[model samples]
Target: MNLAVIPARGGSKRIPGKNIREFAGKPLIAYSIEVAMRSGLFEKVIVSTDSQNIADVALQYGADVPFIRPVELADDYTGTRPVTNHAIEYCRQHFFEPQLCCCIYATAPFLQVDSLLEGYQELHRQQDKAFAFSVTSYAFPIQRSLRKINNGVEPVFPDNIAKRSQDLEETYHDAGQFYWGRSNDYLSSKKIFSDHSIPVVLPRHLVQDIDTEEDWLRAELMYQAYMRDHN
Candidate 1:
């Protein structure tokens, strides 16, 4: 069975109470929870959070908070891999071992049900040896990326010094929206990317990370526009 895990901690330095903060009249995490549930790909949606308020809100929005996240995992320095590992082990101890796992973020409020399910279906259809993640085309050509010199001059990668944006190759970036992978693969690599990692393309507008107040406002606006267009 596939299990969806949403990892949210109590200590958020960028935006306090970000997980439980209201968005579109509901807590932000609710968006991810609802999308995962509506997708119908996963048999269960579990939220691992250190905050009681976050756990409560997740439960109210159709997510199961089976256990409170450990204090060590809640620290700011803790990387997602360990937190995911902890949650997976926790589930295994209580329930059956999950075959597949989708790590959904509480910050990605605009994750589409169709896109999510498609990502899962794509993973299975390709029978990919690695993981799958949702990503969007980069706004700019990464090949044209420039770095600032000590003298405040822009240094180009090719050193051609004059390259047109259109001439550069297009590349995609991880949208940080969500990722799906086999439980065994994740346990082995401790990462979502592998030789066969599948990048499911999504529109850039649909990908938003709410790490700050301004980001939250932008997400709200984008979400409203998205709703209107769909309607």
Candidate 2:
């Protein structure tokens, strides 16, 4: 079976009720659930959350809340791996052994069905690879990044300051949308950012991280613009 585990803890400090907050007309998590269902890729789409409210919202949107995440895995410091591993183990105990598992983020409002499909397909094709996840190219070359020091700014890489942007290697970052992994890879707690994984690149316009109020506003604007262009 293929399983989708969406880890949405209730304690969002940066933005209260962030996982369930409204975004572009529905709860933030609804987007992730809807897209996963629409993709028709999973035998089960489950939301592993500590909030009863979150569980209700997830079930309302057609995702199963078979179990509430444990307190230890629901804290701010808990990483995605352990939460996912726990979910996988739970499924195993219940006789729903997932062959492939995908960890879809609740805040990923920009996630698309095609991107998820691509990651799924890529992971299946690369047997040697342990995982596949979404990524997007950095808007600007990171080699020329700056940092504030006292009253002045300084180049992070002084040696790359003189080099043209075109001469620098292009870089990509985790889109924080979804991750596809073999059940064994996840159960083993393998790292996602290693050479063992593949990346499903997404367009920069279709990616945004919503961590703060400003980020939320920017994401809304971006989502509006994307919808207009796509529709």
Candidate number achieving the greatest TM-score relative to the actual structure: 2
How do the residues 1-231 of candidate 1 rate in per-residue lDDT, one tens digit apiece?
988999989788889888888898888888899999998887789999999988889989989999999888888799877777777787788887988888989888889988888888888888855678988888977766788889775756775446787777778878888888888877785456656688889999999878888988999999999989989
lDDT of 2 by residue, 18-73 (tens): 99999989999999999999999998898999999999999999999999898888
lDDT of 1 at 35: 92
Among the numbered candidates, top lDDT falls to 2
Query: Stretches of candidate 1 above 4 Å error?
Result: 158-161
lDDT of 1 at 178: 88
Global CA lDDT computed for model 2: 0.94
Backbone clashes in model 1, listed as residue pairs? none
Error of 2 at 25 (Å): 0.7
TM-score of every prediction relative to native: 0.93, 0.98
Candidate 2 stretches with Cα past 4 Å from truth are none
